[model samples]
Target: MLAKRIIPCLDIKNNEVVKGINFEDLKSAGDPVALAKKYDDELADELMFLDITASSEKRKTILKLVEKISENIFIPFSVGGGVSEIEDIHNLLNSGADKVSINTAAVINPEIIDEAAKKFGSSTIVIAIDAKKVGDEYLVFTYGGKKNSGINAIQWAKEVYNRGAGEILLTSMDKDGTKSGYEINLTSMVVRSVKIPVIASGGARDAKDIEEVFVKADAGAALAASIFHYENSGIISIKKYLKSKGINVRL
Candidate 1:
């Protein structure tokens, strides 16, 4: 079996790494370049740099920041926020992003997914779904989880996969930054509903949380922010813990 990846998410705001609960109450984490280097040295499976406020600010991602980060880390880096057109994707990739994650843009113009996949290969396109639980099902949210898109999370996962996205970055808004645990039900739902790999995000407090998601939710990867960003658990330590728990992980 392929090893389950442990990814650290850097929520970049104003060119610095930040963390928050339920997507609010933000706190500064540290410099993005330093954090990226730390994770790289510790052997993180992958890294994600999300310009969390770009969409809300109505501007493009920080290309200079992306370039700086790319120069510091060798791991696969995925970038998102304010990515609407194919040109944006090209620019980000050229700026050193290995994959371009699209959330609001994908919801607004899904054809962009297919177009990007065709131009850059499906492996380079990841669709990020920020979801909040509502009634019996989860609803997709946009604009950094500030607005409900009314699109069913499960359906949207399948839609994006069918549209040629190679992966799904599923973030549970309710579980985000709470560190209670992953929303296993939601993660599993999306995992089983789609053929593409699903990277589970939000509510990761420690190694056990990562283990649970991989074991129960069968997530392809577990993405965390506060824990890794604040040094609650380093990537190597988390991987060792998962390996001890019988999970397939690189150590």
Candidate 2:
């Protein structure tokens, strides 16, 4: 079995790392480059840098910022936000991102997924889906979780995989920053609906929460921010805890 990965997510706004509950009321956490290096040193399985406002603000991801963080971290790094075109993906990859995640653009023109995968290889493309549960249906949101795409989340997951996306970064907006746990029901549904790897994001509080997602939902990875950003836990400690629980992880 492949070892489950633990990724530290850094949401960037104005070049600073920020955190918020349910994607609102954002507050600065720290410097992005510094945090990236810290996570790398702590042996985090991977690092995700998201320019939280780039898409909503109508600008490209800060390549300079991506370049700086990439310089500090040796681990695989994934970047997202304001990525709308092949050129954006090319620029981000050249700037040191191991993978480029597209959300709003993918919904606007899913053909880009097929085109990008063909041009850059499936491994280089990641489709980020921000979903919110409305009644019994999970709807996809875009533009940094500001707009509802009205697309069914589960179906979209399968569509992206069929279009040749390498992976899916699934974020539950309702669970985001709550730190209660990942939305397991929602995650499990997406996981079972697609064959490609799915990185579960939002509402991760501790190692047990991660373990639950990996065990119950069968998530490929669990991404968190609060625990790591606030010193509530460290990557090494979390990995050790998961290993103790008999979960396969890279320590």
Candidate 3:
């Protein structure tokens, strides 16, 4: 079996790393470059840097910030937020991002998924889905989780995969930053809907929460922020814990 990945996410805003509960009431964490270096040194499987406000602010992702953070980390790094057209993806990749994640833009012009995958290979294209549970179904949100697109998360995941996206970065807005645990039912729905790998995000408090998602939901990866950012638990310890639980992970 392929080793499940443990990823650290850095939510960037105005060139600073930040975290929040339910995607509101943001609090400063630290310098993005510093955080990136720390996570890389800690043996994290991957690093994801998302410009949390770029899409909402109606601007492009900060290339200089991406470049600076990319230089500090040796592991695979994925960059997202405010990425729209093929040119944006090209610029980000050239700026040193191993993968470019499209959320708002992909919802607006999903054709970009096929276009980017064809140009940069599917492995380089990731569709970041920010979803919120509305009644009985999880609906897709865009523009940094400000607007509901009325798109069903499961259907969108399948569409993204069919359109050539290599992976899905699924985040539950309701569960984000709560540190309660991942939304397993929501995550499992998306994972089951797609043939590609699904990286489960939001509300990770400890290793057991991650283990649960991996075991119950069959998530390809578990992405967390606050726990890692605050040093509540490091990647090494988390990996050790997962291995002890008989989860397949790279040591």
Instruction: Compare candidates 2 and 3 on TM-score and give the better one.
Output: 2
Q: Estimate each model's TM-score.
A: 0.91, 0.91, 0.90
Candidate 1 lDDT, tens digit per residue, 1-251? 79999888887887877653232223423678877777788888899888866444434437888888898788899998778889889989999999999999899999999999999999999999999999989999998898899999999999999989999999999998787999999999999998989999988888989899999999999898767644447678788888888998877
RMSD in angstroms between candidate 3 and the native structure over all alpha carbons = 4.0
- Per-residue lDDT of candidate 2, residues 1-251 (tens digit): 68999998888887777753232212423677767776787888898888866444434437888788777778899998778899989988988889999999999999999999999999999999999999899999988899988999999999999999999999999999787899999999999999889999999988889999999999999998768644447788888888998999987
Ranking by TM-score: 1, 2, 3
lDDT of 3 by residue, 1-251 (tens): 79999998877877777663222212423667766776777788999988766444423446877777677778899988778789888988888899999999999989999999999999999999999999999999998899999999999999999999999999999998788999999999998888999999999999999999999999999998778644447788999999999999989
Predicted structure 2: lDDT: 0.86
CA lDDT, candidate 2, residue 104: 93
